[model samples]
Target chain A: MQFFIEVLLGGLLSGVMYSFVALGFVLIYKASGVFNFAQGAMVFAAALSFVGFQNLGLSFPLALLAAFTTMVALGILTERVVLRPLVNQPPITLFMATIGLSYVIEGLAQGFWGANVRGLELGVDDVPVQWLMDSTGIGVSSFDLFGAGVAAVLVALLALFFQYTRIGRALRAVADDHQAALSIGIPLQTIWRIVWAVAGFVALVAGLIWGARNGVSFSLTFTALKALPVLILGGFTSIPGAIVGGLIIGSTEKLAEVYLGEYVGGGIDSWFPYMMALTFLLIRPEGLFGEKHIDRV
Target chain B: MKNVIPLKKTLAAAVFSVAALSAAVGDAFAQAKEQFIGLPSYRVGAYAAGGSGLYGGWIDYMAMINERDGGVGGVKLTWEECETEYNNARGVECYERLKKKGSTGNSVFQPVSTGITYSLLDKVVADKIPMVTIGYGRTDAADGRVFPWVFPMITTYWSQATTMVKYIGAKEGGIDKLKGKKIVYLYHDSAFGKEGLTVLEKQAQKYGFSLVLLPVAHPGNEQQSQWLRIRQEKPDWVILWGWGVMNPTALKAAAKTGYPREKMVGVWWAGAEEDTVPAGDAAKGFTAAGFSVAGPNYPVIKAIQDNVYKKNKGNMEDKTRVGSVNYNRGVVHGIITVEAIRTAQAKFGKKPLSGDEMRWGFEHLDIDAKRLKDLGAEGFMPNLKITCADHEGSGLVKYQQWDGKQWKIVSDWIEPDREMVRGMIEESAAKYAKEKGITPRDCAKEG
Candidate 1:
């Protein structure tokens, strides 16, 4: 039972961090109606930039600010270069552009910073919380708890911003119909630039946490795989759904791997979440908080 | 008219210079004896740090050989790197691309990946090229009679696994004390990772210890449940058979679960500076197995610093990594390869040899303690003696522990239990031979 609790809490904690990346996807998909395939690469680039600046002898806060500035620049450049030309093209075309953008961003980061895995220090040790372990006999990581706290706070703040702000409403209007939004005097391009910049901030935060855990390397791009499942289970257009979906996916992922992995020769954690998300897709295509679109022929 | 006349004369002079350079290049190629070794390297990807360090040291050693000894028997070593990006498909494509390049058409092929090695097994055989899988690839391929085209040089996975057990036994006072002990075999969930489990399971049964199998998926970034399970079982030790980011992640996870780093043992792939440095303090006291130690104290290494880097012919961007674990391993690889080419030249000629001739050279290659001392790599790497029947020249392993900064040698050289390892190799190789319809080579008749 203690072991069970440990695994369960560990899963929930990781699920929270996954929501951070999922929020990045939600922002762009909700605002622009285009799936940003480069979000993962952005995450990798953001973390690499943070580490790169630190390596250049900047303090942690300066590195963070510089990395955020770089990310904002990357977002604006991506908006002007990749999206501006293909504004009214099919959604598939924009997604394809993001895919190419991912490669370009990866290549650029490699060129700018030499390809070497660097360790990241977020000042939080990844050791288990001693009090929790002593009291409940469950070893829960303190760093994970801190990660979960940061993610939850960020997700809640974003949820409120979308719920109350006029810009957020304008962003939604652009998503519903680009021409309709422009007809009502909403700036589609401005809203998109704002959404991507916010996504970049999200990417930066996600990268720092995950990079601190896994070391800043090319593998940072693969966390998008987990985020996809989160986006699928939670609505891609829903902010709070990301948190709930992350919780569900994270717990089940750990439970299934621990309980069922041994019977299947182990290492099933890598694919078990995908299978669960696929099952969710079959049950609710629109997801819990997702809007149902009725197409007119 | 005057400007046009000058233009024509300038164009004529440029064309003449080009022709002269081309002729000189052609003449140089004809006059100089050159051996080309195909290097399917990974220089820009997830495993780039290791690839850079290894290929850097390998290139430095070859450059030193050329600068110090005027090449092996006056045959200049030439190589072209085709980036595989650590992908198996790219690795095979690189093999096909580099197969027919130089005078002898890729004298030897060494793809530093087990996945690539497995993909090229049949292809290398058909091409009559000898593929050397040093410390990686199929363990059963150590039986040279059935696998003449492949050399799993130095040590096989089986040897490493058995030696790991032997070292653990020595720690436990005696092999007799291994009874009733429980060990967790935490491995990467791949063909390369699973190779060690067979020998470990057999050893578990031989001794009375119970073995628990745990598999970590590729790019193992998260491992909460796995470590939690380790805490529950409280096994005597954990054998970490992982690669890339998985190594440090495992160490960090172990620290998170309050598991002792000293109790964890990593494989050679998991033991490099790249592995430990990333985990920071969590990686301290972690031990791992290796075929070579890391240091720049060796005379060969000093010569490379003086000759290769001093002359601006060095390959490493980070000169500090000249004596890193992966770098030293690559130097060991260079030592064996250069010796094999030297040995081949003695039999074939002082020129570029064919792939088949290189195979013969590998079979006859022997580097003892005296040769190692002469080569200035005595303690840096173990002695090796390749035979017609045994492709794995020396199934010797050295253990090292991480002291927060660098890997410290923990034990003297330990040889694997050859009697048991050889039996398993022959058994598996015979089955493979039957499946592939390959007739085992008669070593005596070849001589």
Candidate 2:
């Protein structure tokens, strides 16, 4: 029972991290109706910039500020250059463009900061919490727990921003109907840039936490693929859905690998989440929190 | 206007002379006696760290020879590095692109990747080019009769596995002491990672230890569940056959589960500084099997530093990596390649040897201790002799432990259980040969 509880907790913490990356995708998709494939590359670029800044001996806070600024600039540039040019085009064309954007971003990141693994110390201790382990007989990584807390705070801040701010209202209007929002003088282009900038911030947070957990490398670019299942589970446009979807995928995959993987030759953690998402797709095609749509022919 | 016409005429004459000079130089390059060594290098991708050091050392050593001695026996040695990015498909493309590049053709080819080696084995055999995989590749390639064109050279995975089990047996007092002892094989889920399982399984049967197999997927980062299982099962010892990011991640997982670092050992691929450095202090006392010495104190390294680095002709991005483990392995590879070329030159009269001649040189190659000293790499590598029957030469593996900073040699050179490993190698090689409809080469008939 104790071992089971530890596995469950571990899964939940990891799932939260997955949600953090998925949130970036949700923010972009909700505002623009475009599936941003370059979210992973953005995460990588942000982390690389942060680490690169730290390497220059800048203070942590300053380096972080610089990285965030860089991410925001990148977001604005991406919107103006890649997204704006391809606006009103087929969603598939936009998706393909984002995929191309991912490659460009990945190449630029590696080119700027040579493709080598660099350790990112967030001052979060990775050692198991002694008190928790002693009381529960299940070791839990403090770093993971701290990451979850940080993720929650970021999510809350995002939720508040989306609900209260004028730009947030404009973003929602644009998301509801881009043509309608444009007609109402909402400045659709500016709304897209703002959303993309917000998405970039989310990518930065996700990158720092994930990079701290696993040393920053090109591999972080692929970790975003794990969020695809989270997006499917949570709805691509629902922020809260992303979080819930990530938790479901994370926790269930852990439990499945621990209890059931041994019988099936193990290593089910790699594909188990996708299987869960596939099953969920059959039951709820619109996703757990995604908006349902009907088209009249 | 008159001065301008004269100046234009002079400029035209100068341009004509420069063009003629370049044409003559091009003709000289065509006629220059040189051997073209094909290097399928990877400077990018998941395994870039290892690739950089390995290919860096190789390029540096070859360049050092050219800079110092004007090339081996006054015959210039030239090489072209074709980037593979560690992808097998890209490696094949590199091989095909560089195979026929030189004046005579590619003298030798080293893919430096097991997957690439497997892909190129048939192609190299058809081309009669000797492919040196060194410490990693098909273990069955050790059987020269079956794999005539391929040479694993120093050691193969089977040998390394057997040597590791022997070291474990010695650590536990005796082979009989391993009886009922539980050992887990945590390996990367790939053909390269799974190569040593059969040998370990055979050892488990011979010695009565229970063996458990666990496979870690590629780019293995999150292994919480895998570690949780280890925590539950309480395996006595763990043997890791991982590469790239899997190495440090496994060490981290082991540390998280409170597993003893001393109780776990990694294969040579998992033993580099990059593998353990990321895990920080937790990686201390982690043992790994190694075939070559670590550090830049070797005579050959000094020669490279003085002759190549000092001249600003070194190929590595980071010069400090000159004596690192992977770099040294690359130097050893360079040594083997140069020695083979020299041997071929001695037998076939010095001018650029063909791919077939290089294969013959690899077959009859011998690098004794005296020869190693002469090559400025004394005590760096074990004395090796490749023959018609044995392509692996010396199946020796030594154990090293990471002491927070650098690897310290913990055990003397330990020889593998040759008889046991040889039997398995021959069986597998014969099975492969029969499947491929290859007629086994008659070693006795070969010179």
Candidate 3:
């Protein structure tokens, strides 16, 4: 029972991190209608920028401000330069362009930063904060608790923004139907720029916290891929689904690997999540929260 | 009025210039049919930081050979780079793409990845292409009798792991003193990580120490829980077998866990500028097993400056970090490949030779004192000799510690626990051969 509690907490913490990255994916997909394959690369690029600014010996707060500013500019530039021309192209073309965008971003990041892993300081000591109950122990990291708090705050802020703001109303209009939204005074292009900028800021925050836990490297990009099934399990267009899906996927992956791996020679964590997500897809084609769509083929 | 020629005249002049340039290029191409070496660099992938420096060093050296010495044996050598992105499948594609150049002479391969090395072992050997896996490869493949074309040059995981145990034994006073000492093996869960486990297990049995295996996930970013468990268990020594981001991250976790860095040891693969550069002050006193001695004043490096750089032959600018471990490995890789070619040149006489001939050269390779002096690698590494059975050349390693600034070698070159190594290699190799249905060759009968 003690082991189960520990593993469950471990899963939830990891799930929160996954949800953070998945949130970036959900934002871009909801607004741009393109699966941003470059989200991992964005994570890497954002982390590299944050680390680079920090390495310049700037104050941590100043470095963070500069990194966020840079990410906003980068988000705007990506929309203007890379996605603007392909606005009317087929969805496949848009998807392929994002793949190419991932490559270009990775290459450029390496060119600027060179290929070295960097450690991030999250302004909190990484020491474990232990808790004991009746001679039984349930220890958790202060850093992890801090991460969960940050995730909750960010999600609440996003929810409030989407529910009340004028731009939020326009974004919802676009998500319902781009053509119908364009029929009104809501400019599709401006809405996209806003959406991308928001997603990029989220990526920057995710990168900072993730880099704080694990040293940042080019391999950080692979984490975006790990968040793929999260999109499937949670509806790609639903923000709340992203968090719930991430937690479920993350917790289940840990539990399966810990309890079931011993019987099958280990290393089931890599494939088990995908299998579970596939089963969910078969059962709920529109995803856990996705609205069912009728295609006029 | 005085400005420009007519459009027709300008076009005519441009065509004539183009014709002349093509004629000159043709003559140059005729004069020297270039021998091409394919370099599959992992400069933008998982291990790109380590890959970039080594690839830069190697490409610079090859450029030097062409500019100063007019290539090896008077056939100018040129190389083209293919980014593998550190994927084994992509590396195989790069090999196929570069293997077809007509002027391809005894080419050498340095994949810098063990997974790719294992994937290419059979293909390159069958294709007769020489693979130079510096510092890491399959341990059993060191027996050239079974694997004739593959060369793991200086140090292998088995040898380094064995040597690390030896160092620990010495540090703890004696092997018997380690009977009850708890040694935790904190490793990345990959082929690269699992490679040294067999050797450590064998040493544990021999030395009577308790071994606790802790397997971390790939890319190995999250380890707070593992470290907490380690703190709880209080292992005496921690052996880190990790790569890329895992190294510095693990060190930081150790620091957070309040574990002394002096008691931790990393393998040669984990020892580099990239690993320590991240965890700056916290990683002080951490030790790793290094196979080669890389320094500023080595003879070969000076020779490179004199023979290759001074004449503007190689890319020997501030970019060429010769003293770094990865760069040294690259330089040694170049020396071994060139020596094997030279050895083949002695037997097959200078002209482009076949892969089997190169294989013969690798098996009967002898790099003695005179050869080292000739090759400009005297103090960098000890003389190496590869034979039918002895594929690793020599099971020697040195201990290095990070002083928050740079790596300083602390121990003299120590031989691996050979008796333990031999038994493990033979048993594992036999098991591998049986699984693959490969019969062991009787060397005495073959001669």
Candidate 4:
């Protein structure tokens, strides 16, 4: 029972981090209606920038600010240079453009950083807090508890901003119908730029936390790949769905691996979460919180 | 019209220069003045740090060889690296890409991944290309009588694991003292991690230690909870079988959980400057096993500096980082490879050796103490030999601790317990034979 609890907590902790990345993906998907395959690369880019600034002897707070600002600039630039040219193209073309954009960003990152894993300090003491009544009961790391709290706060703030702000209204207008939005004098281009910038900012925050945990390496981009299933499970348009879906995927994957892995030879933790995500997709085609759409001819 | 004649002459001069360059290159290839070594590296994947260090050191040593001694056997060695990115598919692709460019077959194919090792085992066997897998891959492949194509020198997973448990047992007063003690095995979930478990299990049965198994996924950056459980379980000791970025992170996690760093032991691959650098001083006192010489003061290392780096030919991005554990391992690899080539040359009349001849050389290696001293690798490794029965040239290892700065050797040159090793080898080799549909030679009956 104790082991199960520990595993559950562990998995939920991992899932929370994954949800943060999935949240970024869902935001971009809703705003542009284009699945940004480059989300992973953007996470890596942001993490590298933040870590690079910190390595330059800058204060952590100041480095984080610089990294966030750089992410904002990257957001605006990607929209202007890449998306602006493809404004009238099919949505598929935009998706493919993100793929090409991923390669470009990867190359630029490699050319500049020369591909080495840099260690990141989360600036939190990594000591464990033994909250279990008994000395031998389940415990949690201070780093993880801190990570989960910060993620919750970030998600809540983003939720409020999207619900109450005027820019958020414009974003919702564009999401409802780009043609309808344009008819009502909403500048689609400006809205895209705003959404892109917002997504980039979210990516920056996600990148720093994840990078702090994993250390800033090119491999951090893979965390974004793992977030794909999280987005699918959490309904790409639902904020709450992402968090809950992330926790479920994370916990189940760990539990299955712990109990079922030995029977199958081992290393099942890798593919189990992905399989769970696939199962989730089959059971609910519209996703947990995905909006149901009807089409009549 | 006179100006046109001068212009024509200038054009002719330009064409002549181009022709001359091609002829020079062609002539260079003809005389076999250069030894073309193919370096298939993976500097952009999960195992990038390790692969990069090995490749960087390899190129550096080769440059040292050329710049210091002009060349090996008066032949300049030219190498072009193809990036495999540590993927098995890419590794196979790289082998196909680089196999066509030389006067000779590939001198050495060192694919660090065990999965790649298993993949390339059959093809390289047919090609007779010698594959050097230092401290990795199928442990049963060490039986040269069965699989002569594979060379896993120094130590293997089986030997290392048994030795580590033996060391642990000794610390607890005796092997008999380990009864009922709980040992938690926290490993990266891969063949590399799985390879050590059979031997560990065998030893656990023999020593009466109960094993608690925990596997962390690859690119093992998120191990907070795994350690959290270890804290709860309060296992007597934790053995880490991790690689790449997983090492430092594991150490840092242990430090966070307040686990005594000395109580945790890592495999040889997990114990390097690269692994502990991220954790900094928090990783102090952490112990890990190593195969080769671990210190900075080897004679061959001195020669590498005097001959390779001083001449502007060393790949020493940071010259101060020379003689590091990984750098020394690279030098040791160079020593073993060059010695094998030289051994084959001695038997085959000293021009250049084929892969088959190199295999024979690897099989009959007799690197005694005197020879090691003469080769400038004194104190870097043990005087060892490889036989038809054992591709693992040496079963020697030492425990080293990360001292916040460098890996300081904490134990003497200890050979694996032979009775335990031989028994484990027979059981494992028998299992391998049954799985692969092959028969093991009965040395006793044959003799």
Candidate 5:
């Protein structure tokens, strides 16, 4: 029973971390109709910048601010250079452009910060929380709990921002209809830059947490690949759906790998989540929380 | 009309200079005064930490030789590194791209990955080039009769695995103490990671120990469940056959599960500084099966420092990594390669030797302690001597423990059970030869 509880807690915490990255994809896709494939690259770039700045002798807060600013600038540049030019292209073209942008960003990140792995010290201790362990006999990593707390706070803040802010309204308008939003006076390009900037901020947070978990390296970009299944399950256009989908995928994969992976060759964690997402897709093509689109010729 | 004579004279002079330049260029090309070594390096990927140190040390040692002695026997050594990014396909592409370079073609090809080695085995054999996989590649390739072109020069994975079990036996007071012990093999889920399973299973059968197999997926980061299982099962000892991010992550998971880190031992590839440094202090007292010590105290390292770094010709961007574990492994690779070239030059004429000549040198290569002392690398590595029947001579391994900061040698050199390992190698080699329909060369018939 204690082992079961521990695995469940660990799975939930890991799910929250996945949700953090999935939220970045959800934020961009919600505002602009194009899927942002470069979210992982942005996470890698942000983490690299943070580590690089910290190595430059800056305080943690200052280094984080500098990294966040760099990500914002990157988001603005990406909007102006890549997305703005391909405004009215097909969604597939935009998706491909984002993929190309991911390569460019990855190259630029590694070019600026050499390709060596650097440890990111986020001050979150990875040791198990003593109180929780003593009380429930289930050891939960404090770092994981801290990461979950941060993710929860960020999600709440994003929810409030989308509900009350004027720019958030414009972002919604742009998501609803780009031409209609432009016709009204809500600048579609400006909304895109804002959405990208927000997504960049989310990437920064995701990068810091993931980097804190695993050392900052090029492999951090692979977290973006993990987020694809989350996006598929949660619906790319739904923020809450991303969070829920991430938790579901994360917990299910961990539970499945622990309970069932041994009967198979024991590496089911790699493909189990994707298989679950594929199964889910068969039932609902629009995803769990995605809006249904009716198309007529 | 008066100036026509001078103009014609100027034209003749220009033509003469062009002809002279072309002749000089042709002579330089024909001389073939340089030997080209192909380096399939990875500088950007999950395994970049290992790659940087390995390639950096290799380039530094070669540069040091050039700076100190102006090349081996007046023949300059040139090398071109193609980045493989630790991917098998890219590694093969790198091999193909670099094989055609240099004056007399590529002297040797070392792909540095078991998967890449497997992919390029037939290619290198067909191309008639020597492929040197120092401590990695097919374990059966140690039998040089079948794998004529492939050299697993240092130690095979089978030897390493058996040696690890031997070390465990020693720790438990005797080999008989291993009976009924639950030993877990926590390994990466790839060809390289799974290379030691057969050996471990055979050892288990012989020694009466239970073996548990746990495979970590590629770029292994999430392992909460795996470690939890280890915690529950409480294996007597865990042998980690992992690389790259998997090493540190495994250590972290061990710490999280409150498992004793000292009970776990990593393979040679998982013993580098990057493997443990990321885990911070939790990696203290972590043991690993190591072939070489990590430090700058070796004479060869000092020579490299004096010749390469002092002269600003060293390839490592980070000067501090000159004496790191993986870097030293790279230096050892460079030393063995240079020694092979020297051996070939001694046998053949003193000019640039071809790949076949290099193969001969590898077959007959002998690096005794005296040779190592002359090369300024005494006590840096075990004395190695390759023969026709055995490419991997005396698989010597040692245990190193990480004491929060660096790896320290904790045990004397231990030789793997050669009788058992050789039987397996010959059997596997015969299987490979039959599969390929290639005739095995008799050792007695060879020169």
Candidate 6:
């Protein structure tokens, strides 16, 4: 039972990290209706840029600021160069452009900062929190706890922003129906640029925390693979759903791997989440917080 | 005022320039004493860090030889790089594109990837090209009687596995003291990752150690469940058979779970500076098996530094990586390649050797301790001799440990349990030959 709790908590913590990356995707998909495949590459570029600036002896805050500036520039560039031209095209075409954009972003990141793996120090010690361990005999990393807190704060702020902010509502209006949103004085282009800039901010935060955890490298892009399942389990459009779905997926996969993995030959954690998300998709096509849509004939 | 040339005149000039350029390129490639090595490199992509270091070292070593030795037996070494991005399809495409390059075509092929090695296994045999899989390839290809074309030289995975167990045994006082010890085999879940399982299982059975196998998925950035289970099991030791990001991730996870870094050991693929430096202090005290040692102190490295880098003709942008594990591993590749060509030159009168001729050279290659000293690579790479029946001349591994900054050699060259490894290789090769409807070569018949 003690070991089980530890695994569950660890899984939840891991899921929070997945939610960090997933939040970036939700912002773009919610606003523009285009599933940004380049989110992972953006995360990688952001982190690499942060590290590159730091290597040049910049303080952490400066590096963060520089990296955010780079990401925002990248987001604006994507708006002007990629998405602007593909406006009103099929969603698949938009998706393909993001895929191409992903390669270009990856190339640019590595090109600017040579492809070398570098450790990130966020000054958060990764050791188990002593008080929690002593009280409950369960090991939970303080670094992980810090990461979860950051994700939670970001989620709350984004949730409130979408619920109340004028730009946020306009962004939602654009997502609901690009044509219908355009009929109003929403200005789809301005709304998209704002959402993408916001998405870029999310990507930078995700990259720093994730990069600090798993040394920034080309494989940091692979974290995007985990977000796909999270997006499926949660709604692609739901900020809160990403968190809830991450928790569910994270806890379940770890628990399953711990208890049931030995009998099933182990290493099931990778594919098990995908399978669970597939099952969830079958039951709730619109997802837990995803808005349901119906076209009137 | 500017005057524009006529369309026909401009076209004729462009055509003549292209024709003249082609002629020069054709004449340069048609040289009798030129040896070509088409490098299927991955300078950019998922595994680019390691790729850059490795191909950089390889290209540098070849450059040094040409600069220092005027090429082996007056045969100038030439190469072309084709980016594979570490993808199997691109690797194969690169192989096909470069097979017919140079005067006598490609002398030998080395893909530096297990997936690419597997893809070109049968093709190399059919094409009469000898492929060298220095450390990672078909372990069973060590059985040269059955696999005459493939040389998984120096050390194979099976051998490395047993050598790792031997190193562990030595640490436990002796092999006899390893009875009933619980050893965890934490491996990456890919063909390259799982290559050590069979030998490890065999070692476990023989030594009375409890071997626990845990697999991490590909691009293994996440290993929470696996590490948590590892913490639960409280195994005596953990053997990390990982690659790429998997290495540092494993190190970080172990640190997070309070697993002692000293108790964990990684394979050669996980032993580079790139592997340890990324995990920061978490990688401290972590040990790994290595075929070639790191450090620029070796005379051969100094030679490259003086002859190549000093002259502004070096391949690596960062010259400090001259003695890194991957870089030196690339140098080791260069040594064996040049030696094989030299050995063939001794028998076939120098000049550029064909792929078929290079196969003969590889089969008969020998680099003794004296030869190594003469070449100034005595302690950098192991001295070995290849024969018709033994493709893997030696199965020697040096253990290295990361002490916060860089790797330090922890153990002398440890030889694997070769007799047991050879038996397994023969059995596997025999099965493979039977499956392919091919007859094994008799060692006596080979020249």
Which candidate's DockQ is highest? 6
User: Residue by residue across A1-297, what tens digits does model 5's lDDT show?
Assistant: 888877788888888889999999999888887888889999999999999999899999999999999999999999999999998999999999999999999889988888777777777778888988889888889888898889889989998888899988888888888889999998888888888999999999999988877778887888887788888999988888888898898888888888998999997889999999999999998889998988787
> lDDT scores for all predictions?
0.90, 0.87, 0.78, 0.78, 0.88, 0.91
Q: Write the per-residue lDDT of candidate 3 for residues A15-70, one digit (tens) a residue.
A: 88888899999998887788998999989988998898888888888988888887
Docking class of 2: acceptable
Residue A113 Cα positional deviation in candidate 6, in Å, after optimal superposition: 0.8
TM-score of 6: 0.96
lDDT of 4 by residue, A145-198 (tens): 887898899789878878899888888888878889999999988888888888
Indicate the TM-score of model 5: 0.96
Q: Would you list the clashing residue pairs of candidate 2?
A: none
lDDT tens string, model 2, B183-272? 999988888888988889989999999998887777677777888888888888899898877787788778777889999989999898
lDDT of 2 by residue, A232-252 (tens): 999988988998998899899
The C-alpha TM-scores of every prediction are 0.96, 0.94, 0.85, 0.89, 0.96, 0.96
lDDT of 5 at B304: 96
- Candidate 4: which stretches are off by over 4 Å? A1-8, A88-93, A130-138, A251-268, B1-30, B280-282, B293-295, B316-320, B423-447
**Which candidate should be chosen as best, given lDDT against the real structure?**
6
Query: Among all windows of ten consecutive residues in candidate 3 chain B, which has the lowest summed lDDT?
Result: B313-322
lDDT of 4 at B425: 68
**Backbone clashes, candidate 4:** 0
Writing each residue's lDDT as its tens digit, candidate 4 over B1-447 gives: 979999999999999989998898898665465556667787665555556666666677677777777766666667778888888898899887776566665666777668888899888878888787888887778776567688888888888998898788878897788999999998988788888888788889988999988888887766655676687679999999988767777887787768888888899888877787767656788889887756657777777778876776677565666777776777777667767766766776555456677777777788998998887776677777987788887888888888887888888777786677767666767777788776666434431
Better of 4 and 6 by DockQ: 6
Better of 1 and 2 by TM-score: 1
- Model 2 deviation from the true structure expressed as Cα RMSD, one decimal place: 3.7
lDDT of 5 at B383: 84
Question: How much is A209 displaced in model 5, in angstroms?
Answer: 1.2
